[model samples]
Target: MPSAWLSTHLRASRPRVLAALNRAFGDIDVAEDAFQEASLKALKTWQQDDIPKDPAAWLIVAGRNAGIDAFRKKRRETLTAPEDLEPVHDGVHPEEELTLSLDRSVYRDDVLRLLFTCCHPVLRRDQQIALALKIVAGLSVDEIARAFLVQPKTMEQRITRAKKRLQAARLRYEDPDGAERSARFSVVANAIYLVFNEGYSASQGSELIRETLCEEAIRLARLLVRLFPGEPELRGLLALCLIQHSRRRARLSATGQAITLEQQDRLQWDRTLIAEGIILLEAALRKATPGPLQIEAAIAATHTRAARYDETDWAELDRLYRALEIIRPSPVVSLNRAVVIAKLKGPEEALGQLEQLAAPLERYASYHATTAALLTELKQFSKARKAYEAAIQHAGTEVERQHICSKLDALRSRVPGL
Candidate 1:
């Protein structure tokens, strides 16, 4: 129990722990390695002695000292073991040490600085997510790989390459400003959303949702909102995450299979999150800037508002999707808009829109899945079967493949065709 508690504490405290270590050591890799070493020490020591009053402060001190020793050893310089450092006597507060460890004003906030570092522009989006999950969100390589639908070794290599790229860039631990700051903010926000999306509908693995990734993204989004309190888009981003995550319980069936939105039990949703998300979205709309995130949040809010599937405001939802399409044009956006069209107009119209997307979305499993769903509704069972098969081939996870197989089998039984 103590170990589990310590593990949870370390994970929650990781950003601060890592930021303090980076402040002392000046290398992201060193900070991560030092924090890991300190975590091991805490597992051994906390069982005997009571956990420190300030665990983040404790981890920082322990990790910083470990980093210094490692750095010395790496360069073949003289080493001062942690045992040689001054020990805290019984009931003596470590306030001064904590102050010295974290008293840096180089950035507006340490966590934000660490986020910027992880989401450095040099690394690709996947690399940014991998590095941020590793360094900022405290996810294991295997966990991140599961979220990304990649092998553990592949994720490990990706994180390694990302770190190497960060080192080569020689990025500083300072808050960005000016045009550069705006660009970095966009990158950071996108990376956070990507993390949330991965968790919302895990690209791989048996689980329909990975709560850790979703929680981490929300945590980071909350931090960003605080850092930029006046930014409407950031608030919209937070609202979107809140509303989407509210359905976590309803997103999967009792047997751990994906449940479509129409089948999800709205009663199972988290009202607290929905209320908070609505409040946030309301505030964002008051700003009148009308950014892409706000539009998307509005779309999510529409779904959250409906008491039943038939009660959904299809007309309003369709308009929101069209607005989103204009703001951010892409094949995926078009596909979503088509789904809205199906709900509003008819399956025939939606099918026509989907046909145009084939050239762009041929490799996308969701495109095939959506097309298959529309075709099945139209009673074009043979065409639906082909689409379902294509979807199965491109499915990202075992659960997805199984879901598509079930659909295909149902269609085959009804249609009496290959």
Candidate 2:
């Protein structure tokens, strides 16, 4: 089999297989190790023999066996009794047992259980998100580290600490009750959005986006929305992802440079996703219990509703951002509102608004980039050049750095020495 095909299959099967393994073994570390073992085995076996009819099922069975073996080894080393080990099945084959337990609903619940466990309230928010990205989304330690702007070692420690915390908490593998699910819903939603953001603008690498991460985040959001259909914020979260993902095709240039939203080809945007997002947003609005995610989705909806870049209702966007500021104020939100101010009130006013955010967002590349753009519009070439340089210095990814460089070059063309 082709390596790409194998890689894709393994990634797709990871959540289901790992979730099942976690349910069976009742240990995240064991489940993860077992899944890795199973994957390694598949690499050798599938190449020598024909691929299994159900790869995930094969993985689940293999992982269960691996977990049992690991336990047996530990039991022997510790002089533990046989009864303390995994139960031995008589007569029934491993595959048969796995098949009996392979109910789709059970797997779905298992996945949710794994997600909630990773996002347990006992862990800090960063720890929860890092753990979820690693365990549930299957992101690499390095990938999670890049997203968090930390070293791989630091991220690994964070994840380790989170797992230890979870182990201490002894969270149940059973599906959460209504109250429990609702309580954990916000953290889960935030983690999913962070996952989406990481994919939407990957922190590092040649590519500007990681479609796999985006797809995984969307899949998780879809599952969450299904589990909580009455929750407006959940609907809004899914809507936000769909609407943003709709522009994936048009977000990059032929040379792999990031494309500005205004410069993107509207025709390339996915109309189906946009339509669904709008419908979801409308439904959420009817509930009238607006949250940050709902407001963010509304902002995105406002952008998509415009027929062209010029047709965008800047005034409406300004109003929405002001509302967002009142509801969930952050430097990032303020930065976005500044862009709308630039469109409606000119660069001078936008720059004034951004000045207040400098202390809070000095290390944020987008803030510098936005400031540079506003400065350029005002024909303050020297200041714009400085801002662009600052943006490039703070850029998290090679693609982002290159994008800022391209803008800087454009600015230089307008001014001889800039």
Candidate 3:
């Protein structure tokens, strides 16, 4: 009966265990098999007695034992590994290894190390994403398919190809050095952030936001920042996640409608995270390279410092976005900066900025909604009504589509011409 919880624990532990096993034996098949075997042990044992206090640690110890045991039972008893790989059974004792049970950090290192390897430039971007989800995030091939809007078989094939590519490249379970180090680190940062984004806000799921994704992202950001204290960009990324995450509580209304950031309750924001974000951003800015994260954190800091939504410093934000554009110009960032423009000048000025920039976001309802809002501000009711109608066409969620329809109806109410 107690075995019920075992499924949940194993699912969560799979990615971490895979990471640890691959690091220990340098073989994905062995690592995966060991984790599966360890899950069996947990199911058989936990029901008889109390579950281990630190279940992840217990599972890790079990996995190591399982891996070495299988390695010893290999096809050829006299087989020898290369100089880079020592036999798992060579002078290794499980009792001594289990003694380090309290040190759960050791097992966690594999997940982090695997993350670094998967994000290596040698791997294609899709490969990096699939590998990270397959390994670090513990997403099944089916789940990854749903996330990417692809078929399950397609995702399975993608993962298979990525794994083969990773092995062919002989990617090590260690962070690279010098030029490779800096580049590889950025990929790792991006992968972790993407995982968190998926969890924080589900792209394909019915829910507006997924708390698990958000928590995982924040956790990874914290881990990376701790591991690479000297790297300012890492710290900047952590700060950005922290600040954005602080507003999670107020993102959805009581009826589960997605609330705009300005409408979100400022008091509900996580003050601790905001303060930490500010501290991290300040530290990260010391390095001369003004990166995208630094700019994002700067913007988040401004929001965190504001007494109320109306009190947000638009001029400072405009200048910061300008700096951000120089570093990494993005349509999304430009759209965000337009909100400040609407506040400082007028909707017409903001509309001008939006028009000049090509928004590849036309297919997205949010893009249409934003245009409609600006048009409404300009008193161009007919145009606003038309944009809102278009917005409803692309709206992904029912709640968003309802809001767009309401906007369209409001315009129609004022003018029969609409």
Candidate 4:
């Protein structure tokens, strides 16, 4: 995964180089082309020269030279004598002096600027996320596809369409201000979270979870936090991720099976992450910014605090979900809301909710399995058997299929007629 490390470093520096080149050259195509040229040079240069002390500065210099060289070559092709067809810089501009002092434009706001550019108005939201992850985050097509729980070729087409949209609309590349930046920021966050979630869940990989991917997402979130310390929603996001990450070790059983939240070993959770999550969540809430992430973090906090499953604050969790629903409503949230109903109201009331969700729930294994589990708990063995069979039918992985099979066997054992 040396490429992974290199990619991160390179991606982190992209904005810096792109921003500087864009500022100096005043053209998006010219700046982006120069950044690509500089990246190639880094591939050749960094290995042989011990990696420049400031890689960003190195990239900026290389990119600037690239832009200048490209302009000169174009002029020669036109058979026109050079007449100051290059960037003119004023002497003593601190920015220019800083650019001079650097090994590259590593610290330049170019990467952020690049993010703003990729999520421009022309691109569809899904396409924007895909393209940004591809170009700015340095994720491969497979990686981007896995992130979105879709096929690689599908993601490839999405990104292709995104680029076409940007070209067709001729999207501008200047650093965006107030509203533009805010809108773009959401897409960037969603893209990064999507990457982290794929890595975290590993829907197709051998491992059920990849801690490194989660860590990478956490790192990205932290970087965003540093870039905008006063943003409460950002703090909520960071807080939510930290808390969930803290429970990773506790999530699996001894044989690597997926353990339900009610069954996890709380003792194995990372206190460091949990503590940090709590602190961040508190700070965010102090600003009264009650976003989805902040609410989710509070739910996680409630889980982390409980000494045992019986002690879990299901009532409080139910309340949190209710509040979260007010802010953001989805069938998934409604499904979760039913869990609280099962715990507090009764299996029948919860079953009503499940039945209400049948249109959306029919294809999902967890939805079927959860319905079956509730039936089993209610001693409705006949109904439970049917639900378990459905779970097996739709199960995405062998592990899930096996789990459902076990549930079916238990339900069959309880049935007398057969």
lDDT of 2 by residue, 90-138 (tens): 2223455556667767876777778878877788878877887798778
**TM-score of structure candidate 4:** 0.79
Candidate 3, 166-185: lDDT as tens digits: 78888654444567767766
Best of the two (1, 3) by lDDT: 1
User: Ten residues in a row with the worst lDDT in model 2?
Assistant: 84-93
Q: What local distance difference test score does each model get?
A: 0.81, 0.83, 0.73, 0.72
The true-versus-predicted C-alpha distance at residue 332 of model 2, in Å, is 1.0
Judging by lDDT against the true structure, name the best candidate: 2
Q: In terms of TM-score, which candidate is stronger, 3 or 4?
A: 4
| Residue-level error in angstroms, candidate 2, position 249 | 1.9
Over the stretch 1-418, how does candidate 4's per-residue lDDT look in tens digits?
Answer: 5556655567777655666676677656677788888788777656632566566767777777678888778776666434543443422221354456644233325545566666665666677666655665556788767656678889888877777776688655555677766666666666656556655552355453256457666876787777776666777778878888887877666666666677788888899998998898888889885777778778879888888998888899899989888988877788888988899898889998999899987898888888988988888787888888888999987666766787687777777673
Please state the error at residue 239 of candidate 1 in Å. 2.2
Clashing pairs in 2: none
Candidate with the larger TM-score of 2 and 4 = 4
Q: Please count the clashing residue pairs in each candidate, in the order shown.
A: 0, 0, 3, 12
CA RMSD of each candidate after superposition: 4.2, 4.7, 4.5, 4.8
lDDT of 2 at 387: 97
